[model samples]
Target: DRCRVTILHFNDVYNIEERPNTEPVGGAARFATAMGKYRDQNPLVFFSGDCLNPSMMSSITKGKQMVPILNSLKVKAAVYGNHDFDFGVDELEDVTMETKFPWLMSNVIDTLTDKPLADGLEKTVITWGTKKIGLIGLVEEEWLVTLATVDKDDLKYLDYVEEGRRLAKELKEEGVDLVIALTHMRWPNDVRLAEQVEEIDLILGGHDHDYDVKKVNGKYIVKSGTEFRNFTKVEVDFIGPKYEISTMKIEVTSAYREDVEMKKIVEEFTSLMSDKTATTLGRIESELDGRFATVRTQESALGNFLTDVMVAATQADLAILNSGTLRSDSVHSAGDFTIKDLLTILPLIDPLVVLEATGTQIIQALENGVSQYPKTEGRFPQVSGIMFGFDPEGPPGSRVDPNSVKVDGEYLVPEKVYRVCTKAYIARGKDGYDVFKDCKPLTDPDEGPILSTVIQNHFTAVDIVKGLKPCRSGHHQSLIHVASVAK
Candidate 1:
């Protein structure tokens, strides 16, 4: 006799409301309605993680809004993405407690508790349609260092291929009919796992924000689109000892009606954001281009403005802010800049830190920033007191021209130490800036100002100077320089 089962998978969702005037207006409400159509198949829903922060709404809620949205999905299992731990392990654990499914972190372990990182399950088995299916979650090691709240030294991470092989073998030995690897990693790593791990019958992945499906070593690797845009519906037919699988990409567009309950849930969380949008920060004379296409590819006016604020706020000789820090993905026209616009540009409360980095380390960091040029990677640098040129055709480690490098209008001196103002994320060696890890923290995160707050303060200083708001005695006058530089 043959048995059939269905699987529903999606990943990297951030916003709950529909993106107005955008194609495939994939709101959580519409996504829920779309998934509801498959209920008759008794599909096992799986999520590849990253629903916790970075969205405009999540910025205010600190990801608390994701609890209800996740619970509504009735997810069977999930793997943790890098952004899931953005709030911290403890906060994630709390969010997990409220969710209805099991989260798996098969490779990462907490040395302090001697358990899976975030206390996630290492493996789980469930019976669906007369077959026993084994699930194991896996992630890449590259992003482990990037988790702001997680200390790499305090945790142990195993290779995904090794862990997938061992776990799938154990599950097969336990009499499971099929094994599936739920992974949060890039395409290459998933392909590597599919090739190396024979015991795993299928793989579902996340973290790349692309909708792709490929078969390697007779196993299928699937990645659903991000932000509730699309989902993968996999059909598995088990015939005695073998199984045949097929997948369909289902897009969530305006054609589908929103589920009332889900829409209400979304409205409840979003209504709280109304009051925070009206307070104007200041007026800009020209459009500040914060779109990813501009900021991640090359220096833009928005990048210069933000980096200028960083250098002014921390009084560092130079500043480097990752393009990823600017997330609005849209341009702000020359007009009244509001708190809403600032929050959209910088949703995360990134604390600034001053690092005493050598000129060599600075060069290394700049090289890393341009390593993935033209690919729109987040590691691209937006700078203020430094300038360097890179050849896109050059190799990654040698892209930046040493001769073009200058700090404070002078050529870089390899032996000289310069105070660099940057997000605490970079100081911890995130986004391929490992050269900064060993550098001394000239100013700790505690002593540094929050990035958004600094921008807001700069505007307040501008208002004070314009006599729009009365100034207090001894108000620092240094911030007014940022307004002038932006002009």
Candidate 2:
């Protein structure tokens, strides 16, 4: 018997509706349009994973809003992304139930029960005509540790390579013809799995958002870039007892029109989001500009404001935060900073923390923070209440001359102790600040509480900077800009 099957895949869609500014890209309607066209010619449509959470739009809706749109597109099956657990296991279970398609997570298990956390559907079997397509889903284990929202006690992520071997063996024993490994793990992990696992015919990937299709260790691996900009279509032609992929095409969704029906669904959701976003609390005195290419490289008025808030919130002598944490540097145009704007800037739910450290540890920590400056490291700290200078041209460790560095007009005393205010992310050694990993925690805050709420309560209002002067002193220069109330 001869059979033909096509697998349509897109990773990291992240709630991008097809229309222009009216909505984000990769909306259900737009994806439906693309899926409908393919389904008309074929019968299978598969999403690799990472279709939910991480966006303000998705979070506000608790992922319920995406179900109808995905159902409309006839998404047969999708693997789970790390963000799927952003709201917690219960919310994720709700999303799985609401979704018309089967949400597969072969690597995620209940730590207490040692059973699959998202189980109800078959883990590794999807049929197309007479051919049996084995589908195995893999989520990154590191997500259990990195994500601020997820509770380690509630969930357990099994090793991808080990899970891959176990599932592949089971699927092959069941007379599966081709094995498709849908993963939320990055390229290196996928490559390692491909090399180790012999039965995996294709590795469909997400997470890193790099667009590339390459064969590693005889396995075909494909990843579409983030935000539904593109998708990969793999056409399999079954010849006798064997199946071979005859045609593989990368379809750019941006080239085609958004599906009309899906567009309507998106428009309705967009209207709801807009109405909700209109409730503004306070106003900015001046425009808060955050053009990333310009401001992030130096310092942003918004960034300074956030650091000041962290300092005040912790009542620490100094504060340090990453510029990358400020997702967008869009200048405020004399308007209310809505809840949406705040979420966009600070997407992660990292809580503020105060740590006791000596002046020497402070300088070491600051050096660790600015160590990767100009390169735009996400953990790069934007300081408050304290100022220091650095020379990128000089040696890495010697970049900050002790003579030039100062805290309130005096050289840093290596022996003196200082109370530092920073996000829990830094204290956990997330941003390459391993020095703080062993440091005693002064405060351990809960997740889900908004930092913006703290800012609103502390400061009456914000006054944006206009034509802020650059801080330069002798051979060293301070990267921070903007002014904020001292703690």
Candidate 3:
């Protein structure tokens, strides 16, 4: 006799609204309805994390808005994504407590607590159908270094392959029928785990937001799509000593009715927000590209627009911003732009600062920026008042071409000092920008203006010039000019 089980998995959801003008307009409401379609199958729900912040709603609530959304899914067990810690460990801990499931962090340990970081469970076991399923969470070392809120010294990261092998062996010895590794990492890392860990039966992964499935070494690695757009439905069948697996990608489209109960919960939080977010600020003549796949891998018009604004507002010679600062993950259409649209693109209150750095340091920073090229890492630079090119296939630290580097239309002189405008996050040396930590700050972070306000003021200035609002002068003219040119 054989047994069967079903699993529903998704990752990297940040918004709860139906993305206007986008197909499969997935929202929490519709996604909940889609999940219920598998109710009779008694499916086990699993999330690969990253639900806590970076959304317009999450920004206002410090991710509190995600609690009910996650709880609605009845997730069995989950792995933590790097963005989950954006608000710090304490906030994540508090948010997790309100949810109705366990989060796993099998490889990373909090040295202070002598336990999994964020108090996550190292492993969990559940009986489904006719067999016991054992689960463990794993992550990559790459993202651990980039977490701004966590102190690297307070935690320890274990190689996923090593941890997956050891943990799977333990689970098999304990008589579980299957061992599943829930991982929040890139595709290469997931493939590595599948190939190296013979005892693990399957890998459910996150971090990169693509719906994909691949088999390596007779094991399957699955990643559901992002933002409630799609989910992966997996089926496992056992026949004697051998088992087989199958998967389906379920799209959450308008064809499905919104789950009433979930819709109410989403509305409850949404109604708390002010209507001011809808106020029209300006019009876009061209679309702005903010998708991670685009901005993190190359220079984008949106990036240029933002960094230009930074340089103008701070009165710096050049500016560099990490691609991660743009979180909307969508292309903004050429039309009316509103406060809500602006917040969706940049939700965090990043303060601007001016740092004086030698041309050598600037080159080093650009090298570090492209170090994670083609992987969509946040360290990638989006710049203004400067231009440079790199070979994507070149060695990480040596990729940036020195001859291509320029500042204010002049080739960069290694010893020449230039004023660089950037957000305070990188100014403090986070996101692999180690060359910036020691740079002299021409303007202290505390004294600098908030990024969103500067952008809004630019719009206000434009509106003033258009005579749509009360006239304002002097301080905002430079930013308005920069923005107009970019537009």
Q: lDDT scores for all predictions? A: 0.84, 0.65, 0.83
lDDT (tens digit, per residue) of candidate 3 on 1-487: 6888899999988889888677789999999999999999999999997887556665456578888888888888899987787555766787888889899999998887788988899999999877999999999886764454455677888888898889889999999999998998888999988888899998999988878999999989999989999999999898886789999999998998999999998888898666557777788778889899999998887888788877766568999999999999999988888888888888887867789999999999999999998899989999998999999899989999999999988999999999999989999999999899989987656335557655655565566567786521112224435443443
| Per-residue lDDT of candidate 2, residues 358-423 (tens digit) | 777777776776676677567566777677777877665566666665666577787777777777
Best by TM-score: 1
* Least well predicted 10-residue stretch by lDDT in candidate 3: 471-480
TM-score ranking, high to low: 1, 3, 2
TM-score of each: 0.66, 0.63, 0.64
Sequence-dependent TM-score of model 2: 0.63
Among all windows of ten consecutive residues in candidate 1, which has the lowest summed lDDT? 471-480
